[model samples]
Structures are given as structure tokens and as C-alpha cells.
Target: MSMTLFCYLMMYCSGIVSLCLARKHIMLSLLSLEFIILSLFCIFSIIVTIMISESYMMLMFLTFSVCEGVVGLSILVMMIRSHGNDHLSSINLFLC
Candidate 1:
């Protein structure tokens, strides 16, 4: 409805598209996922602020983002340490 909301929507879509297209690249894909998640968190915070005019929700979302970032980086580090190549296909066997 608002310009900010529309911008967030477009960014969210672009992040999804980038992630889907960057299959063999581990770093790019993981970062793209983070981008999507960050955008979603931003959108939710914005909506919450508009509804309640509160900023604590933004801090809560950011804390969750920090946790997700830590986990994603840890997984990537392990993937690199084991395979020496950070591609998704190389990590799938570990999952299965």
C-alpha cells in the first residue's frame, strides 16, 4: 500500500529470485537468504510500528536476525572446513 511497503516487497522478491538462481554458490545463496529474512523482518517491524508506534519490536526482530546470522555463518564455516568447497551439492550428503 505505502511506498515503503512496496519497496520491501520488491526487495523480498529479488532476494528470493537471487537465492533460487545461485545454487552452486554457497556464500551467495546464504547471504541472499539472509537478505530475504532481513527484509521480512523489516517489513514486519514497519507494520508493527505503524500499528502501535513502538520500537521495541524492531529490537526484538534484530535480535532474532543476529541469531540467524550466527547460525548461518557457523554452518557455512563447517561446510567450508569439511569440504574445502562451499557448494550446496557438496553439503547435501552430510544432510542425508
Candidate 2:
């Protein structure tokens, strides 16, 4: 594999590890998730470039990733406003 591909794969793996290990802050988890998405986007773009294919799919993926980021930030903001903090453990989903 190319060095660039290896780097991206390493980034993706690191993001997964961080996401799994981060059990305290919701923000940390979100950041890890974003990192994973970014790595995937980079890999996808590289593949598209190598294949000389149309970049519309990459553009669409980017648009969806941006939307996902906005939604995640809004959720984080809402959680902070309602709970006074963004701690993952503080969120009690069982509470009705």
C-alpha cells in the first residue's frame, strides 16, 4: 500500500480507538467521530482520483458529512444547555 493510504488507515484506526476509549466527555467522542469521517473522506477522494471517476459522489459525501457535523454540534449544544455539561455518563436515556 502507498504511504498516503497507510497514513489514512492509521488515522482511521486511531480515531476508532479514541472513540472507544473516550467514555467521559461527549465532545471527545464527537471529535473522534469527526476524525474518522475525515479520514474516510480523504480515502474516498484518493480512490476517486486514482480511478479518474466523476467527483460528484465525493462532493455528496462531503455535503452529508458537513450536515452530520452541524447536527452533532447542535446536539452537543442542546445537551449542555439542558444538563449544564456534556458528560456522556450524565445522560440518562432511561429517564422518562
Candidate 3:
């Protein structure tokens, strides 16, 4: 693998590990997830660039990541408003 690809792999792996370790902390988990997404985006962009001359794949991935981030933020806001906390355990999955 190239140096850039190796760097991306390391970043992606560390992000995944951080995400797993930060499961209990909502903010930390979200940041780690974003890190993972960014690394994946970079890797995909490079691959797409090499594979095709006309590629919208990177744009599509960027949009998807933005949407995902918005959704996650909305959920966090709702959870904080309703539960008065941002911890995963504080969220009640089923409430009637």
C-alpha cells in the first residue's frame, strides 16, 4: 500500500477503536464516528479518482455524511431535552 493509504488505514482503525471505547460518552462517540467517516471519505475519494474519470461518488458520500451528522445531532438534542442527559444509558429505548 502507498504511504497515504497506510496513513488513512491507521486513522480509520484508531477512529474505530476510539468509537468503541467511547460508547458510553455520547459526544466522544459522535466525534469518533465523524473521524471514521472522514477517513473513509478520503479513502473512497482517492479510489474513485483512480478508477474513473467522471466520479460523483465522492460528492454522494459527502452528502450522506452531512445528512448522517444532522440526524445524529437532532437525536442528541431530543435526548437531552427529554432525558436531561446525553448518556446512552439515560435513554429509554421504549417509552409509552
Highest TM-score: give the candidate number: 2
User: Who is ahead in lDDT, 1 or 2?
Assistant: 2
Measured on C-alpha atoms, candidate 3 has an lDDT of: 0.88
Pick the winner on TM-score between candidates 2 and 3: 2
- What's model 1's TM-score? 0.84
Better of 1 and 3 by lDDT: 3
List lDDT for all candidates, in order: 0.86, 0.94, 0.88
Candidate 2 ranges with C-alpha deviation above 4 Å: none
24-95 per-residue lDDT for model 1 (tens digits): 977898889899988898799788877888788788878888898889889888888988988767666666
CA lDDT, candidate 1, residue 36: 96
Instruction: Quote each prediction's TM-score.
Output: 0.84, 0.93, 0.91
Instruction: State the displacement of the C-alpha of residue 60, model 2, in Å, after optimal TM-score superposition.
Output: 0.3
Q: What is the C-alpha RMSD of each candidate to the true structure, in Å?
A: 2.1, 1.2, 1.5
Candidate 1, which segments miss by more than 4 Å at Cα?
92-96
lDDT of 3 at 72: 85
Local accuracy of candidate 3 as per-residue lDDT tens digits, 1-96: 489998998999999999989998688888998999999998997788788876787888899999999988888888789889888887676974
Q: Model 3 misses residue 68 by how many Å? A: 0.4
> lDDT by residue for model 2 over 1-96, one digit each (tens)?
499999999999999999999969989999999999999999999999999679999999999999999999999999999999999778889995
Among all windows of 10 consecutive residues in model 2, the one with the lowest summed lDDT is: 87-96
By summed lDDT, which 10 consecutive residues of candidate 1 come out lowest? 87-96
